[model samples]
Target: MMHVLYWSGRAGSLAPLCLLIECGVPHETVQVDTSRHAHKTADYLRDVHPLGTVPALRLPDGQVILESGAMVLHLAELAPSLAPAAGSADRAMFLNWVAYGAGSLYPAYQRVYHTDHIVPDEAARPAAREAAVVALDRCWDVVEAALEAGRPGLFGDRPGAADVYLAMLALWHPAPERLAAACPKVRAMKDAVWALPSMRQALAVHGLETA
Candidate 1:
């Protein structure tokens, strides 16, 4: 059994908990609230992670693992049934999608968050919001097409790392209404992935279960 150090309500940490649920292993979720700045303490820095980010998984051997990308992928590997098998091309594709979500999509989402929610200047809100909306639209376009491309749920058989990550993105995205209107395929993917039992448990706990 593994123990996970996490902040359940946080955007980044939520998917990791979803991964844990999908993994179907006996693990414990140690709540770390970022809103209260609990992850910034020295004890957590030394004990949980140097960066003190939530969603760090503690190994049974006492090793602490950090970073959202690495955490989910590691859990995916450990719970191979949750993710895809690391055999050949499918493995590489899975990694690509996973990395793409963390790297490109996350950055793009950050821009949207900064422009939409975090920014304080009311005068510049429209321009910034438009810019962020454009970035988000571009990102979703790719995802929408990918969801429509040949495979239904990130892959043929089941939802893999890509599907899971993308589903969370769709769930946490700022402009879900716009996405539903613009990218029905991605909306379809979101519906399919969230329908999984793992996603249900994770999202349901946080009141994110609604369509």
Candidate 2:
């Protein structure tokens, strides 16, 4: 059984949780309360991860893994149902979807969200906000086009790790009201993504899903 040690929030590890669900593999999700500095505690780190990050997965043999992207890639390889066939069209699509999230979408979201976390000082927030908006707009456009392309799923006809990653990333973005209105494609893409059960669960965990 795979054991995923994670925080309740979606944060960076949200994709892994969704992938675990998609895999339908026997596993357990341990909610690590970050507010209490649980993730930063030495005991938690020593037991599961050297770095103070949640989503440190423990394999049955006792190897621990970190970083959501690498973790999901590994999980995909383990659970073929959630990945794609080697050298097939599905595989190419799957890999592209995965790359877009971690390479493009995720970095863009971080560029925006990091402004809040990294620039806590009130004085520096304005310039940071400008750069964030520019980055966010560009990211949204990229996703917007992909969804408009009419792919049945991120990897064609089925959801995979990449689709999960994109959905989780969208939750962090929140599809800003005006932005969504201006870009129907973005909202459509988000709607299509959140329509899945696994994505919904991740959103609920992240406090992004509404009634």
Question: Per-prediction TM-score, please?
Answer: 0.86, 0.80
Q: Give the alpha carbon lDDT tens digit for every residue of 84-178 in model 2.
A: 78889868877777777778876777667677777878788879877887777777677667664455345545556666666566656644675
* Cα displacement (Å) at residue 30, model 1: 1.7
Best by lDDT: 1
TM-score of predicted structure 1: 0.86
**Evaluated with TM-score, which candidate comes out highest?**
1
Model 2, 85: alpha-carbon shift in Å? 2.0
Q: Candidate 1 — what's its lDDT?
A: 0.75
Candidate 1 per-residue lDDT, tens place, 122-211, comes to 898878877877887898888777665445477766676667777777776777888899988888777777777887888776666465
The worst-scoring run of ten residues by lDDT in candidate 1 lies at 1-10
